[model samples]
Target: MIKNLVHHKDNIVTISETMNCLDAIEILEQHSLRNAPVVDATNTLYRGNIYRYHIYKYKFHHPDADLAQVKVTQFLKNTTRVVHENDSFYQLIFAIRDLPFIAVLDKENVFTGVIQHDVMINYLAQAWVADKSGYVLAIQTRGEKGELNKLARLVNRKADIQSAVTFEKTTYDTSTYLMVTLPEYLDVSSVRALVNDLTRRKYDVNVVTL
Candidate 1:
């Protein structure tokens, strides 16, 4: 399913290993990129990433260094962060947390494509059906069993449940936030009724219009 997040090979911007820092900086600036993946001489093997700031910082620290002599490989990084096509979404999430994107390679280490954070945001937006009109009920619970079923039962009686996503557990109180969405056909009264029901059941609930 994570393949849906991948930007295919032809869509990736790459800098050749032989390319100088001066040229790489220009290309990165033109694309409004902070960094770009680097490839081997044949442009098949993925070397790593080259950052625009790193090139400028290097020049500032070493003013005498010739820009033409500075190859992109000199500042290559995140070589080990690349993922295989079959890698999982959870793995990609951790691998790309600190990176703008993660380069994806084939079994032979051939550069295939990349998965960027922006694409991940889009995927999450699609999952939330953000473009469609709906109301989100942000509910907090203590992870008690039967709570979700009760909430679902109550919501379904009044409105169609568009989607439900559980956010990460809160460290402070060890509670979970469940975002339940209602279809556009429902009104504020429907949401208010559900909120009152959940509140009476000791479930912390709030409604947000989307």
Candidate 2:
């Protein structure tokens, strides 16, 4: 699963531990990169992660210090952040949250590549099927057993489902929020009929328009 999301080793931009901050910064700037994986001399083992901002921050403090003498290791940020290839998608999301990227490794701890920040955004868009023209419904209902199945039963009678997701309104609250997308060709009459059915069953539903 994660193998599909990873940018393989050959596609990665990496920095060696022996490289000075000056050379590392040059590589980062050339690619307009903010983060890169740091590796050992052989480029096999993962050392840690470095960010362009940390180097700039260091320079601001040690104005007279020569960056060429400074190793990239001095600025490593996500040193302990890494994911094994078999890790769950849930683990990947939590580990990758808000970072430029996170390292991916194999069973033997060999560096594979990374899961980039932009890739996660695209995954979310795909989950919502954002590129397709469709009817979307924003629904709110009490958190209870079989809520989704009941809604599905109603919607199936009217149109085929394109995508669906459920989330709690708040951690401490009992309310549930759901988003469901339907086929684009389904007529408005069918859509309205589905909504009416849901409402008659006491579900709070809204037709979401983009």
Candidate 3:
């Protein structure tokens, strides 16, 4: 999964402690970044993050103020930021949607970097495309292994299917389930044939779309 590739990469923008509000705004415009992390001299920990909207609004309201005199810290967003590394693409999508950009924090809450919404979305889309395999939810069975293999083989014979798998075991009975994805759509008769074949073999099969 793309979650494994998520890490504190150096691609993230950073602002120095000495940077003024104008400097931070200029940097944000230059890099096309909405938010950036503020770091001290050693660049060990992040003090806060500055959003472009804050700077723009301040400039609009206080047009006559000296830009150099305004401190970047004064305009920083003081709220706690959500961050995650190695989180699944599914989780990352919701996180990015909920938060502006998740600050990639280390064990000590030290800022490592940030994951932008666009970047994370692209990663998730790619992962979805890669995981083209089909999934099935089945009831547990006594001889599930052999039955699943045979069912998979039957499906593959009619279509260009790949990577069949099962999910979400229910404990009501010994029934097994499998999920398969085909390169193309299967006709209703083909699906019915599969159900009939499983029934004849004394295996209770339920096919579901995922």
Best by lDDT: 2
**TM-scores for every predicted model:** 0.90, 0.92, 0.58
Clashes of each: 0, 0, 10
In model 1, the worst 10-residue window by lDDT is 166-175
Enumerate residue pairs that collide in model 1: none
Better of 1 and 2 by lDDT: 2
lDDT of each: 0.84, 0.86, 0.65
- Misplaced by over 4 Å in model 2 are 171-174
lDDT of 1 by residue, 1-210 (tens): 677778886887889999999889989999999998998888788888999889999999999988887788889999888888888877878888978898988778888889998998788787777777478888886676887787788878887877897776756765587888877777778778888888887888877888
Q: Per-residue lDDT of 35-150 in model 2, one digit per residue for the tens? A: 79999888778989989999999999999999999999898778879998999888998999878889999999998899998897898778777777468887786767887888
State the displacement of the C-alpha of residue 171, model 1, in Å, after optimal TM-score superposition: 3.5
In the range 25-49, model 3's lDDT, one tens digit per residue, is 8899999988787877777666777
Residue 80 in model 3: lDDT: 61
Give candidate 3 misplaced runs (Cα > 4 Å).
1-9, 86-91, 98-100, 130-210
Candidate 2 clashing pairs?
none
